[model samples]
Target: MNENMNTSTIRGPLDHEIRDQIISAATEHFSHYGYEKTTVSDLAKAIGFSKAYIYKFFESKQAIGAVICTNRLAMIMEIVDAAIAGAPTASEKLRCLFRSISEAGSDLFFHDRKLYDIAAVASRDQWPSAVAHQVRIRAIIQQILLDGRASGEFERKTPLDEATKAIFLIILPYVNPAQLQYNLDTAPEAAVHLPALILRSLAP
Candidate 1:
């Protein structure tokens, strides 16, 4: 049985159940087949729905694709929030979120071929939502830096915005397009070095 199917009916959250199935199937298809290769019909089949049912739920493939973006963003935010809760300092929180983002990449949506295809599409086409998500992440990092300054953990002279975004700028080129691309083994070292590197900007 496909994990993406629902047998129960007659409910509110259960209606949401079908939507979840659709998302799961679309994720697999996109990750496995890529944007151009994955079809609405395949998505419908994966969700155990008829073509008409898919149309009833989503106006088009693009609509479902947009939902994919929404789901991916939500997953990333959940990780960030959870990481921040466990972190003691703003700098640590920032590191936590970066690590969280990297970790979330390994989840079904990001690491899977169907899911990575969305990222590939965004990278290739320069999708606005993808760009927006990146901006928000950079902003979040900057906010952490500013807070660290308030606590005297970061240098007063550090340009938080630039330094925050620069972290990604530094890592972007060497990153592998496939998988989560975290130095999971080296992440603890990075967690330490990353904060220090940002704090360096504040040094006199």
Candidate 2:
């Protein structure tokens, strides 16, 4: 075997287990070293695999970062959605969603700065997965508003499209990952107060 040959070509794309391992290793490197300083070769060495093997799974280090941020956002959304699923009223659902999202943000920002930093970069770079995650989050907020309108929890005549966008802007400070560090240190009270304002704005 030629030492110069691309090992990725010799070996097929990695299976699920190997792909997960690469993500796990990449997360560790990214967390400790930060994104710009972390390299594909670094992940390869840390995972006990050749650089080619890592490439066979991830297109680049940026892609790995994107996957990590996107997955984290998706999991948080799942938790938020699940928490609000059984709420008996639209008002309660909106409250649950806001509280759940606030809790998730605290976990990401206050407890895990490293992971939060990675997500901030992903959002700034406009990674496709990150963009998709934002769309899903917006839709979740929209659905809740629509439900509220139907149940007379919110003004029935309000336009949901505009309402959804407005709500996103109103809560942007608390929900945006890029703002997490600032909010955690200086504006902890906003987490509780902003959501209350949103709930009030939705009242019929």
Candidate 3:
């Protein structure tokens, strides 16, 4: 046994189970304590491991934070992907997009708020990946509209460029975290009205 091994990490096939356990424990710690208040020791105890045992799976607390953030983002992406996959029309895609943003106060996002805050503080002006994520989402929405155009399901009320921006507007605030914190109750309304607003703006 490597005594020098980090407590937050695990190895082998067992490591994955250990890894997920840490993430699960971290999620609860994060939600109640937020980023600053939560500690790796809290995580270890949550998993019934020693402080050093927790380090075995994670090199540092920051590494654990990274895992937490990525997991949450992946969850959000899954929801977004499913929405796009299930949509029969550009209009339906718009509704999913709206719902994505409106419901962003998810456990995943809430738990990883610390990581996001840290990133912004570390380099407020520099997030290439964040920019890229937005670009990809825009591309997906644009593709949906182009498909709508081909199917004659949409009237092409605006050029794709303008329409894409309009679509982004609907979901941007709700998922933004900062924006959604103001009022939690408006989410369902956001899910419904945003699509209607976009359709009104884009449909024949």
Best by TM-score: 2
Best by lDDT: 2
Q: Candidate 1, clashing residue pairs?
A: 30-114, 31-113, 31-114, 31-115, 32-114, 155-202
lDDT of each: 0.61, 0.72, 0.62
**Model 1 agreement with the true structure over 1-204: per-residue lDDT tens digits:** 011112221123435877677767877677667766767887777767898787756666765665676567667667777888889988678667656665565453435656656654554454554566666666777777777778877776546566766776643421222323444455445545665675565444
How many collisions between residues are there in candidate 2? 0
Task: Write the residue-wise lDDT of candidate 3 on 4-121 in tens digits.
Answer: 2233343334447877787778766765666556677776776688988777667766566555554555566787888778877777877777776456544433555555453332
Ten-residue region with minimum lDDT total, candidate 3: 118-127
- In candidate 2, which residue pairs get closer than 3 Å at backbone N, Cα or C atoms, i.e. clash? none
Estimate TM-scores for all models: 0.67, 0.84, 0.64
Instruction: Give the Å shift of residue 143 in candidate 1.
Output: 1.2
Locate the minimum summed-lDDT window of 10 residues in model 1: 1-10
lDDT of 2 by residue, 2-121 (tens): 121123332334457888887888777777777767777877887799998777776667767776887788888888888889788877777776677767877877666777787787
Off by over 4 Å in 3: 1-17, 44-59, 104-136, 155-159
Q: What global local distance difference test value does model 3 have?
A: 0.62
- Alpha-carbon shift of residue 173 in model 2 (angstroms): 2.1
